[model samples]
Target: MHVLVVYESLWGNTEQVARAVADKLGSVGTVDVVDSDAAPITVDGYDLLVVGGPTHAFSMTRAATRAEAVKSQSALHEPARGIREWLNLLGRPSAAIPAIAFDTRVDKPRMPGSAAKAAKHELRSMGFGTTVKQETFRVHGYEGPLLDGELERASAWADEVIAALGLGSRADR
Candidate 1:
């Protein structure tokens, strides 16, 4: 199985989770990990695609929200285009590719929404088959060192995704 893992991260938390996911997926098959800004505009060749980003304003970051992140976080990397824009530009896939979506969000009292949820919807709209429920990894704050164990959780989630997609032959590794 070939897998592509793409992510948009303002403060790197999501990127770290994406890497963990990719690393775990690597055990099952070949995996290519890239930032959303560098991801392909079309989904082809890969059997599975995993996409993730930081939750901004309750969902995927827009240009305005990215600007806000840049203004508020000194260490944040300015991305050319976030997952929202990348997905928008990525037209519907020609064939059904199994996909999973995840997001990094602040561990607030009541987080309003989820980027993963919105991303899943977007992927389905783009004609990709979503094989796993959307997942969220928590952060302590906006520019965060993710909540404890989130990376490990992300890796575990990757294993689950592999199993769900019936690509579990190498998951034990």
Candidate 2:
């Protein structure tokens, strides 16, 4: 199985999670990971697509939110374009390609909503089949190293995704 993992991150927390997911998926098959800014606007050959980003303003980051992040977070590098724009450019994919969406968010009580959920809805609207439910990994704060064990949790989720796709060990191949 070939997989593509794309992500948009401001403080690097979401990028870490994307790498973890891609690394785990790599154990099962070929996986390519790219930042949303660097990702191709089309999904042509991949069998699976995984997209993730940080939650901003209860959903994916908008241009305004990205500007705020750049202005407020001195350590953050300027993002060329966020996942929202990347997804918008990717109108739809062939029905054979399945997708999963994830996001990194503050671990606060009653956090308004999730970017992963919003992304999943968008993917569905674009006619992509989702093999797994949208997932979220928590961060202790806005700029984060990720909450404890989140990377392990993300890797485990990749295992579940592989199983759902009916891909057994690739050792024999």
Candidate 3:
């Protein structure tokens, strides 16, 4: 299974989760991790897509929110287009491409909204099938060092995604 993992991280917390996910997927097959800004418009030649970002204001971050993250908040990089915009502008795939969505959020407050849920909805609307359940990794606060063992859990989630999707290592394949 060739997996393309795209992510938008404000303070590198989300990137950590993405990396853990890629590590597990790499065990099964080839994997590439790309920042959302650099991801291809068309997701072709890949068997699976993994999209994630930090939840901003209960959902995916927008231009204004990203700007705030860089200016008013503690994000290290300059503000730019994020997963929300990338998914919006993504070209439809020629064939059915399955996807999994994940996000990083504050672990303390237990927010109601989820970026993972929103991202999966967008992918489905764009004709991508989702075989695995959406997930949320937690952080201490907005610009945060992730909580303990979240990376391990993210890696384990990747394993579950592989099992659920049956991408490879199946007798049929």
Candidate 4:
């Protein structure tokens, strides 16, 4: 039940959510939460792949978008590579490994489009099975202190994903 939680975060909000999700998943099995660029080239050893990123221009971040975020100087941290580029560079897995996607977006003016949705397509395109449905955590604005309780919700979502997969191996459960 090894899990790989890979993500791209601009303002670190998405990174926070990613860690919270990985924390819950740790009860099930080993979990490695890494930046998208630092992720493995292949999904060979993992049982599940959980991916997340901040929604940029309504989808996964691009080079231009990331540059813009950096230019705006609003991000606490910027990923060296975004999820979009990482996926492109990833190797095609031999099997359709189970996966889920998540994103951080503006909480107030709920927008159209989702990094999660786009990520689902990318993962499926790369032969990964889309297991649990995609989720979107919210932030106050672009560069955000994540809206309160999003971390809790992220952990809960991890448990739900495991349940949906019938993994039934949470350490506490």
lDDT of each: 0.88, 0.87, 0.88, 0.89
Q: Residue pairs in steric clash, candidate 3?
A: none
Clash pairs, model 1 backbone:
none
Cα-based lDDT at residue 81, candidate 4: 85
How well does candidate 3 score on lDDT at residue 150?
A: 95
Residue-level lDDT tens digits of model 4 in 1-173: 79999999878899999999999888889999999979888989888899899888889998888988988856766677889988888898877789899999998788899999999999988889996799999998788888889999999998899889887875445
After best superposition, candidate 1 residue 138: deviation in angstroms? 0.4
**Which 10-residue window in model 3 sums to the lowest lDDT?**
164-173
The C-alpha stretches of model 2 lying farther than 4 A from their native spots are none
Candidate 4 colliding pairs: none
Candidate 4 lDDT (Cα, whole model)?
0.89
Tens-digit lDDT track for model 1 on 1-173? 88889899988999999999999988888999999889998778888889999888888998888887888776468788989999989877777898899999988665889999999999988889985899999998788889899999999998898778878757354
Model 1, runs deviating above 4 Å: 170-173
Would you list the rank order by lDDT, best first? 4, 3, 1, 2
Error in Å for residue 162 of model 2: 1.0
User: TM-score of each candidate?
Assistant: 0.94, 0.94, 0.94, 0.94
List, in order, the clash count of every candidate structure.
0, 0, 0, 0
